[model samples]
Target: MNEYKDASKESFNDDFCSYLEHHLTRAFANAEDELVQKVWCDGVLMPFFENQTSKKSVNDTKRIVTKAWIGQDGQGEYELVIKFEKYSLRKYARGSSLQDCVPSERTLDWINIDLARRTIEIQLT
Candidate 1:
């Protein structure tokens, strides 16, 4: 199965929400506006397309952020719902050099991402 196949409702609620909030914080890190703290990710309605590149056997995927809704709740918190085209792990090149398999050497050509979010979020204590 694909590595990202487990992006279920629970994952969206528990994982992706916080992940997006963190991403939002970083995206606005260099900005001078007050929008950063007011941002929050509430939910998602993701519908994935077939994994077109699965047959190719690479370990990265590409996604398109299709839509985003941002608004303030009646309460003090802000809410968000982001939509995106489903993504699957991208395929590796057939003629890649042996060293290319090293993660630091391998590049994900599918999506544009912030350098801070590029590092793994979970680490052993």
Candidate 2:
């Protein structure tokens, strides 16, 4: 009476693939860079790692960025919080936050620097 008893391995695999594609599409909708999507598709999603976190050092501070979306504050300023080991930093933006998550490697998609606005919009494919 097991739920998977009647299902073949191939059928189960296909179902899993379909489910993955659906969730990937949803994730990509909010993604700002094609590189991020590719990394998710190849590394995280394919490997079944739903959540991921990365660390980077800037201005002598270790910053960490995760897969979860950091919601905006009441002042309409969106805070992109990153964690570095035990410490965390928050980067604020006026509009939506960009895809700045670190992949498996140290590579990062460089976006145009706008110091005046303090924002960077990543161009997604």
**lDDT tens digits, residues 59-112, model 2?**
144422222221121121222223222211232111112222222122233223
In candidate 2, residue 27 scores what lDDT? 52
Q: What TM-score goes with each of the models? A: 0.30, 0.21
- Candidate 2 — which residues are off by over 4 angstroms? 1-12, 34-125
Model 1 scores a TM of: 0.30
lDDT (Cα atoms) of all candidates against the true structure = 0.29, 0.28
Cα RMSDs, all models: 11.9, 17.0
